[model samples]
Target: MLTSAPPDDASPPVDAGRSRDAADARFEALARMARGHFGVSTALITQLDAGRQSILAGAGGSCGATLAELASCGQTIADAGMVVVADTRADQRLRDHPLVIDNPCLRFYARCPLLASSGGTLGAFCLFDDKPGELDDEQREFLRDLARLAAMAVESDSTAARLQEEADALRANEGRMALAIAGSGTGIWDRNLQTQEIHYSSGWKSILGYADDQVSNRIEDSYRRIHPDDLAYVQASMQAHFERKTPSYEVEHRIRCQDGSYKWISSRGKVVSRDSEGQPLRMIGTTTDISAMHAMSERLQQSVDLITCLTDEVPGLVFQYRRLPHGEAFFSYASAGIWDIYEVSPQQVASSAAAIDAIIHPDDREAYRASLDTSAASLTPWDLEYRVQLPRQGLRWRQGAARPRRLEDGSTLWHGFITDVTDRKRIEAELQEFATTDFLTQLPNRRHFMKHIEAELARIQRNDGGCAAVLMCDMDHFKAINDQWGHALGDLALRHVATILREQLRKTDMAGRVGGEEFAVVLSDADIPAAMAFARRVQQRLAATPLAEGDQRIALTISIGIAVMTASDASVDAALSRSDRALYRAKESGRNRIECL
Candidate 1:
């Protein structure tokens, strides 16, 4: 269906070696699907070359935006951001692109690069249209997310192909089941349990593809028609129902149809009359043509078999999440992968769906609930990334994606996968921290400290009666320590001082290494008196602690400055300046004391 060749003899297989493209039918279908969703004239998986670009899939339409004009793809690759130009003509860079100047000129463009796990950009998925276009934030996010999926498809082609094969097999089995159910026949039967007599309607004979005259009215005829293997089980079940152990008599068994082949029959009946002795005198039921039902059941068994196989082979938790109309959530099925991430087995989660939900980090639960509500309302796929708290492992990153279905009864079901993305998230966090954390003290660097200060300032603005304070700390005669001992001991001294700060500060208070041998703390909701007291505690603690090397101990001391945020203090910088001036006073008044302003 996605042949990249020309029609008839002129067509040739796509040149895969010359360009990087999915070159697969599935990928082509996905490209077209994206095109449909975007309502764009052209959508392509393209290999964006330095000077030229080649369409790998979809319509193979060329975009008018060239490198000299506005190489959106080039910019996307360089910045690693999804690029979108709502109106190319309005932008000077793109206004000169060929598409904007030519007939049937393209006016809108958007693209997300297909980045490989190796961190290399591998072409891109792009959309272009003749008319000006725009996309909302959610739509852009979806586009970028879809590009990630596309990258996976391209990278893991073999896995996708194997899944397709299994899907095809399942679909074929479904077709056969449907045919069997459609060609079924029904019959009627009644029996007098007390008299040991049986009666069969003409329809009952016709159900077996036989005339009424060919069948006997005796109960033996029914017994002889049942398959030997199914007779015992059918008889036991019906006996239980007749003895009042079950609510009704219903059983399925194979019976000989007229064409010499066995067909499945589901016989059902209930006792309409009872004797005075509290015993059933007679019972009647209808026999359904259930040959198709048996076939369908077998197909279902095969489906479960495949599901079990795939679930075990997959890398993440597979689950069927259901929410009933009455607001009850049930986890119908869960894979063994649940043990790896949640520290709980599949059976445990299945036993109670809330067990998994409850383990989500408390701070993340509200957003998770809101996402679920929105997805259920719009029947949209739920793609969420959040943190989960494991009893022993602390908090970890988890990404869940579910395809939702709404039932007639107002219940919702989601077939989804939840993967443990903790490793990736941790690496990302480390990379980000490396940029904003001081390597020596392992505290926030100057830039990161400013961000926290701004956030706390915003909190104060939002509060009706709020207060905050800043503490500036500097090591006294730190230069002499490095000169007397060595830089290694000086580093040790910094680490020791960092430890002291962490030990003395509350979790709500933030400490940062803003300069060499200089540190600062931002205390939320702290008054001037509290700030001054905290500074004195740190000054005393620093005076008591000493850094020891093999045979000698170096006395350690610090100068502290405190400044509380005031009504006239316009910014964090203003309060920080006041604290710095106070710190100067502490240093001037004989180095090892506290000063407040």
Candidate 2:
């Protein structure tokens, strides 16, 4: 039903202006071979120009067609490789094609591109059938071989001359190709599954420390060379490909070298030929030595594991902190101890320090930022002790020390450690309290009390209208009390008087047990009359509150002397002597009375 034209008499000439008869005869032989090999009804060697396709030669009653008529062949040439439509009517791109809907309706079509020696696609070697059919792997490979022949025929003046030239070029490049493959530590392999014979390239033999003549070509010999532990795995991988469960065979395993030691290798292959039942008949692949890569990977893992172990065992949070030039800061690395010190996980601060910053005591956060800024500016060591109010631990102290380094990117990185120092800080505070406090009454001891007096005197000397009074008080009948009630009652009496004095004083006033059965008070900002009134109140309170224990009552009284400490007094002793003289006169008169000097 389809029309055909006679071969164009004015068709473009073939390569090198070969006679039309000779070129057609050469291509006709290749076309006939393709038809017989694939059992197709027709095969055509066609040459394409911009407008139309010219049949250079034909087999099985084929004729010339235009480029639009052989749409599948044009696609093959565009693909620059084999293209097959098992059923043209079943293909979306070709279902409406002219050749598929017309007389001699093409049902199946397959073609391979005819590549010129210059690597450009010239046309395609095409097959056509009136019935839908498919090509197996073996048939596909055969079609490719035939297409290669067609390409050579189109490029050459004579087939024999082209073959000789190809042979000479192959001989010339063989050494260089082998050297390159050997230098790259890659080897080629071909296996005939039917014959159970294998061939290795010279480079492949050299990988195992063997010369080309020293290695065996038998497939069983190749199996024996694989390490015993890896042989079963390698066989399983290949079997999977043979069963068509995998697209190709690929595996990494050990193989025994010529010296009886093992080297790691990676093998990859694909089935190139198969029998009628689809069982693989031949395979081709490459092998690469991977022992060096494997060893380096193992060493890298060991190093990572070692560093992890060391960091976990350290006592504090060992960390790396980075501050960008734009003033953004984060901890790049932190050990597990971050949980113990900051009550937060390491991951919480990995990208931003905001989580850690939120826990810092509000009063100390400004100081913390300032310290870091100063250190970064000076490129100096960062050392700080600050407080944090953690969710789990409440207010706690942390001590951190680090050395800052400027990175090449104009950022700063600090390698540092942060530790919980709350316990140490508590102990220091307790020691300080012990040094300044009286053991019996918990008041400021004489030494500490004198420091306050000196400070008050200095304030008065500053001439700011500051006035203060110093009072010296001595217990009357102290010897009699100790002898009658034992020193235990005497000490209780002293404590009882101390309690009364403290209760009567204002926050600005200070009292201390200055000596055995003697006490002193400094009334800040008080004149002599105000000081005398304070002394009389203390005397009356002690008289009323006698020491009573187990129905035994012991009366207590103290004689207080007040001396106005003027700004002219150079030292604390001047005021102390005046107060003592006044106290003597009060004791000589009635005890339990207040006097002033």
Candidate 3:
């Protein structure tokens, strides 16, 4: 739960008549502004008292509950800055609170404090919704701006009430009226529309760095001091108020200061008097210098632009990924390169990762999810190489690397990069094939075959009861064929025999060329009878097929010797030696017949 400060006691009590009505109107306007700007379901300006919080103004819903039941606003005031809860149900501090469990049932909430000029937090400007949501950096800054405006409106209302109470006293002392206006830190203006003359207080002249006598009372002179770009907008606002189209003339624009530099200012006024025909006769308002706020907004925008430009130019998908405690995940920020990597736009996955997940290879999807879960649990750097089936690229490989950090909200956030690694994976597969394959026959070479037999021997030892057979086969009179028909035909004959071996063997069997004229085979889960049957099929197939090149027909035959591999066998070489001895016996017994030992 969040620690909250005691309620502020510095707030002045609000009076109940016209002053309260005016304050409510201003507060409602600000609440509506907050609701529209944030696109939330509800917005409110709430004032906090000793033990209760009251809603001064609300938009989108009505609060029927008592002031004491709404404790969130008091917490916001104690925060003294912005506070965001992405999901109220996921928060320990609010999940059991009455406001969350009852009507409105808020899930998302964001609040900014309304601070008094005396440095006390008096209330809060808040936005909320029934669905879980979050805000970006720019949205947070905009909320702060709205909160500042709400605070200023509150202060202005209080000051207006105080001045009205002292109106009689001020009328008796003219100097005191001027002092009160100046002390409020804002300038006052009175305009006579019929006479086309304006009167400004000493505070008003001082805002533009001018003495009271140095400025003119002519309305045309005031227009000349406004920046050329802002003249039309200012004039339009003023004309609208004069025609009674708007309730007030309120505008923020640039004005030329005494030093000839433009400074931003906010001007507010309303017609206080009218003629018999309803023509505007007089207007009164206040002006506030807002150059500092305008400058800060400009700098913030520049920084945001710079960061966006840099991230867009990166070659891979640079992103911030977040995984909630409930196993939900999304990409909060993704760079432009997301299009090339996942074949999906960044905006498509900004709120959910389902679009990207749909493209992952079905066979690899489980491993992908498991890898992330492990990394998130341990808070380790995640590294994964996975395949994806993209719409445009077909089958492709991707490599991702990220560092995970646990957040205060029980979510894991990662700063990561994902890049297309299809080319690298293809190269690695090709290199592996070259190392293990016999180039001419496209079968396993001697070294790879020996390693395969060793693995089989280990498996036999582990299981202790399965039987396998190793066979050694020699091509009959290979040397004579090479000498008479040339080495090329002899090589062709060897490949022909290799093809027969492949065609006759079971899927579980292995075959490889171990010598110039010799081949080896391993039959898994086979006994003596099964081994002899396989040898006869290979010999018959070889004799039935002949190599014929331009009417030269050559019939080939292979002699096979089979030896059973037993669990008692010391090594793969021991089984091979027995098979070799059996081969010599087959050759001695007149060549073409198979022998078993």
Candidate 4:
């Protein structure tokens, strides 16, 4: 029901063949104006030939039934020259029509006829729809007026055949162009700035999940279909183009379909023509899919940014090198931290092979060269650890590992990791010291002493060296001292004994406090008599000093047992057991004494 039930006089009369093109152009303009007032896809100017008496001048999708059919039904208003379809199915004449059956999607249509100057019916201006609907009297009169204007344009042509020829040619070209655009997978749109009218191709409507016939004149309809997040940006770009600031523009945006899902599209557009004053008259645009491309670009940028940040922030020298065409090494990547770690800038490292070679310790230079030679000759990975002499930082260790890559020109490329291992090397040395020495006394502990004893035995066996002795000393009444003076004074006495023993021992001997109140000393190059003499000296020293606690004098005695291991001694355990037996005997004989095995 798209037709108006208005009086015929409401619309102006038409003249024939005077200004056909001008009249049709006016019809197009009137449609553009009426779009804002009453939203519709388009208002068209059509003419049926003289033989087609029923629909000669006008046509509408729903109400433009055959003239004989409408006449039989008494539904036509010749005076007003308008046809309306309140509801396509409800109208008996149109329910079984071919348009209704063929295009089940369309449910409404309306049209108004225009008069020729010769008082003959020529053509009509029409509005079409896929919906069945009613139009009020006011809407009907407005549509009738639009039809009258369209009729004037058509009849102004010199002959009806000429007018019809132009229409046929225009439609043929438009049809071919529409097919091409649809196949190209591009959405096309035309916007008229002066009239605020939009002409969207079928492909464009398909992108938005709508039939081309369903489009409305309102621009807000297009805006609402765009994704909410992308709406502002699209609007801003459009405004900028409207201001004549940009001649052409491109933007990536998201568009929402009828069911409310969004797809990423790349929009590209150009302003085709401008007013005489240089303002934009119309713009044309197309949209293409770019979601996958944008995603890959973003991922690549993230990876590059991550690598850049990590290399800049990490400590120590990091170098990667590849072999050049000739057998020379050339740096590919080096971090800024190389300057801090090597006291040599990356620039110096990359300047020449001799520059890096000069920094290597003399002892390691030849070995490093051999390693590189081996790597270049074979496909195996290169891994080497060595020391370097920094200009000011003394000797530092570095570890390098690389894999060989054969390039297109038969040249080899070595990508590798180089890190300063100085701090790790220092920590390892400290750990080895801590493992062997007693933390409190700074003397070799029981474990280290045993190891040294075994070494001495091997030395004596191999070289027929003289025997050494193990001196075991036990403090007398040491527990009683702790009870009387508290453990602090007892600690002081133990330290005193340790100091005296150290002063008494030769540089070749090793000493350690193995247990509470007990100390052992190994005389590496001393025989039995010499060991006995040394033990007696330790005993005498222990007795001579009476350790004091705040004027409370405490006399202390020590028992010493010396086990002498001959050059032929088989095991250290036997020697240690013999020392224990002698020590018990010395305690029994009298506290301040030394006994030998």
Candidate 5:
């Protein structure tokens, strides 16, 4: 809480000697009126802060309490500025009000706003009862009127001090102007035509980190703060300012602060007063911290240096391209690894975009175009890998990505980087091929097969004119071949059987290696009879194919089973189960036969 010294009672009374006397008399009358009307132990009139409506004065000890203690009463009474009675013993909202629950002395209370001369609520006048009671509306109105009169007297006392305050403010402005012109611990000089002597402020000595009393109040003494490199130019500027009536002077140079550290400060000043002969007389100005600005300038130069170094600094190709309306166009972007990736200089590729586009793999150009088209239409980011031809070398894979932003003219500009990703792309393709195809037969593996099954199931579900049939085929007598001609011969026989089956199936049918000796086929648009016929053809083809090894021709046979899939099947697992059951029955019936389930 901020506390101001209480006004002296003996200095001047409001009525007898000054306006305060009248204010006291007015407040005394208000207290009498409130006490008579409220019939309470004490009736007090108080003032409130203008910026804040919290009670600043009261009848007795209540005025001494900080605003935080009053809580809800402070907000309610201060804002509404009307008669409010919190009879805690009877009113539920205030039954547990802080004043009643915490300090039993305030069981009932009534307060009416004290109106300032401007008609703003300044504070209140009220009576507190130790027991619950209420004040009627008429009595409340009477107390409010009396409080208004008391507030008016307070305003009258404030009016008396207005002139003295204006005088004090004018004196403060003069001091500020003098100090500013003198400069804060900064040396300033003026020539007096009458004496031909220079005048400087105490700051002149302090600018050099010297005590004002220790240093002679001379212009040269203050010049000690200027860096030796800038002292000559600064001296010359001052000479020109005085000789030509330059009106103003400014310089950003190093200065010695109080702690003896060299800090950069810009001191600026303008002539505030001059003699009748057009000669400069007085000046005023300020010094500002420019260390941040200097640091930023230094960082900007460093960034330029870094960019200059990057032209030949890195290893991999670092090229940039901008997307244009016709297609993605290459500007004069740079790369350090242009020679390494494409056996060409960055200058050559930057100048000729058609030459760069010619390097894209013939098969991958359409894919690259589609990606660019999608990105341009949506204004979305794009990343793609495409093969580029290298001079006298094989193809190299390059990964290019661009971030596009829409311009005000409804055109898109893309900022993109191209990097050599041949090694990474090669590795990724190997991994993907390994994941999707069987190693031994080079056919679609289980993971890829399940993807096809799901697509076919979805198509059937959508009434897209296709029922899919899954044919599970197991090599017959494969263990016997391994037992007779060794595992190598048996492996050759399996490969031969897989090749024969693939050739026998239609182009629409997908064949996959599902297990050690088991294979699966997804036949599109093939119902139960069609699938059975296809399975029989695969069985007969496998039975006829002969696996050729070192010196032997091994004959192979396949037991085939087909399952026509329906939408009611919960998952691929259900379809595979049905196929497996059919395969089991096919094997039980006899080897080299086709069965449907």
Candidate 6:
């Protein structure tokens, strides 16, 4: 039945001499074409090994080199397609190669990679010469087309050999196969299905630590060693085979070893021939030790079960990630719970991880990609908390953590979890806002404003070269305006001042409503002159803008007091205190006037 169906791990048949001759003949035609078209001295088709290449065919001549000695094909192979180097000495990647530095002193080189169907680089078709040259777009494209044809030829040869191999393997003699199996540390058995008895080879008895004569050839003798829990399944398998339900008798079970412990084994067999009644007349099989495989499978099962339970009960997603060497990525596994968080199915993300990228908030996508690149570069764990936007859900914050590893083939894989942290983030933001930001103005309140000032001072002190200035502004006659217009318009007027502060100030500057009708600015790295200039600008802008309600327009003005963070001012409070006194002086001199201290 293995011949009736394709096997999972069958390799193609091989004939060293004849296959080599056929390969060389086929490639010689191609080598000739390449040499004629490119006018190169050497044209060869090669097979790449880990640290070397074997020249299969050539025009002009062919030779081999250790990869360390000259890996002239390396660049083309890595690129996985055509590469043209105009001058070998000008190419840094190939400049120091022995072939370039010494003999022939080859100057021109162009090669196209022979790609395998499985996406691995096999080797290259190369053209080399002493004269420097370059290819135009049409010539480069022509080389790629030739490489594709070469790949098709390789695949055709392999497929024919594989078919022949399967036919031969199907007819391999049972006695010879059994003898071979025994030599390879496997056990063989022959069974009479009608008699319900089996003859086991000496190797089978040895596997269980039984003396050859101590074990009987009877099937019941084998039954005694099988684990009790496997008895019913074994009986069922035999019955199904008798009914012809399965193609063969293949089962995995634990058998009691001689020391009274179990060892997992895989039994594979087929009915060799059938009687006139269509019953199985004879069956032969081989047993392979699978204790290590069983243990690993059990551990894997535990992990799967754990994730399944969490997918149903937990509020998040879990996944296994695969990233190929060429930057293509997919999710090998994703929990169904992702649908709730991302409004996308596990299958969708599994098929293409780009679907997840599409839903991530646009503002955060660059950061997300950057984090992955950085993590891959450093081989560090990736940890990110970022916002994602959904059409229905609006914006939400998600926390993600993944451990990344580089695989042998140069790809990277990550095992990660993503959880909905929106509620927690919201709570944290509220708490922080209440502590530092003014409820009415939505600007930093007094406490946080002072903290900002403290930080700026620390930065200025460390750098020891930047300037700083502070401005104190109070609504002119704010108490009288509140008395006449009521607290509502008074509140509106305060908001008006806060808006100007936000719209006019640079991002580097910080402004806060430090108290009722009192606003302040901390200009980082601003000198006394810059501070006065800013104060004058605010004076001009506010004088021109006014607040209106129900056809009533009220003109407004603010008096500003400015002070610089000079070398003598050790603390933010000292600058603030000076600005406050300056404001008092400004109020006494004239309302709407700018005063500096």
**Residue lDDT tens for model 1, 185-237:** 33556788777777766657777878868877677777888899998998899
Residue 19 displacement in candidate 2 (angstroms) = 70
lDDT of 1 at 271: 85
- Which lDDT tens digits does candidate 2 get at residues 212-322? 898888998999999898999999999999999999999999888888889998899999999999989999888877675566446446656877688868878898999
For model 3, name the residue pairs that clash: none
Q: How close is candidate 2 to the true structure, as a TM-score?
A: 0.55
Candidate 4 Cα deviation (angstroms), residue 214: 38
TM-score: which is higher, 1 or 5? Answer: 1
Number of the candidate with higher TM-score, 4 or 5: 5
Q: Hey, what RMSD does candidate 4 come out at?
A: 26.6
Model with the higher lDDT, candidate 5 or 6: 6
Pick by TM-score: which candidate is best? Answer: 3
The better-scoring model by TM-score among 4 and 6 is: 6
Cα-based lDDT for every prediction = 0.74, 0.79, 0.82, 0.68, 0.65, 0.75
Q: Which ten residues in a row have the lowest lDDT in candidate 2?
A: 1-10
- Residue ranges of candidate 5 with Cα displaced over 4 Å: 1-176, 179-198, 211-225, 232-247, 255-264, 271-438, 444-455, 500-508, 528-545, 568-597
TM-score of each: 0.48, 0.55, 0.61, 0.44, 0.46, 0.48
- What does candidate 4's lDDT look like per residue over 1-597, in tens digits? 213322343232232333323434445455544442454433445454543322222122224443233222222223445777656667765676555555565465566666765677665655555566678987886676555555555544433355356547777475666666664446778888788877777777776677867887567787876788889998899878877777677788887776777777788888888888878888888776555445534644665577657886777555677676676775667777767666766677574556678888999999998998788789679899899998788898988888775664777767667788888989998999999987766777888888988887888788876777888888887889899888988888888778778878888888887888888888987878888888777767766877776777777778888897767678877777788788889889977778886
- Candidate 5, 1-597: lDDT as tens digits: 111211342111111112222346546655654553455545655565533333323332233332234322423332445545556556554555555566665666676666664667665666666666775676655566566555655554453354346446767474454464344233444534344444545555455465656644455555886778888887777667767757567778887766778877677766666688867666555555455446535644665567647845666555555555655466456666667766777777664566666777899988987987788799788899888777777788888788665643555656566777878888988999999988888888988988998888888878845578988999888888899999887777767777877786787778998888889998988899988877777666655656776686777888877898877776777888888899999999987888888
After superposition, the stretches of candidate 2 with alpha carbons farther than 4 Å from their true spots are 1-304, 462-465
Root mean square deviation (Cα) for candidate 5: 20.8
Q: Residue 485 lDDT in model 1?
A: 90
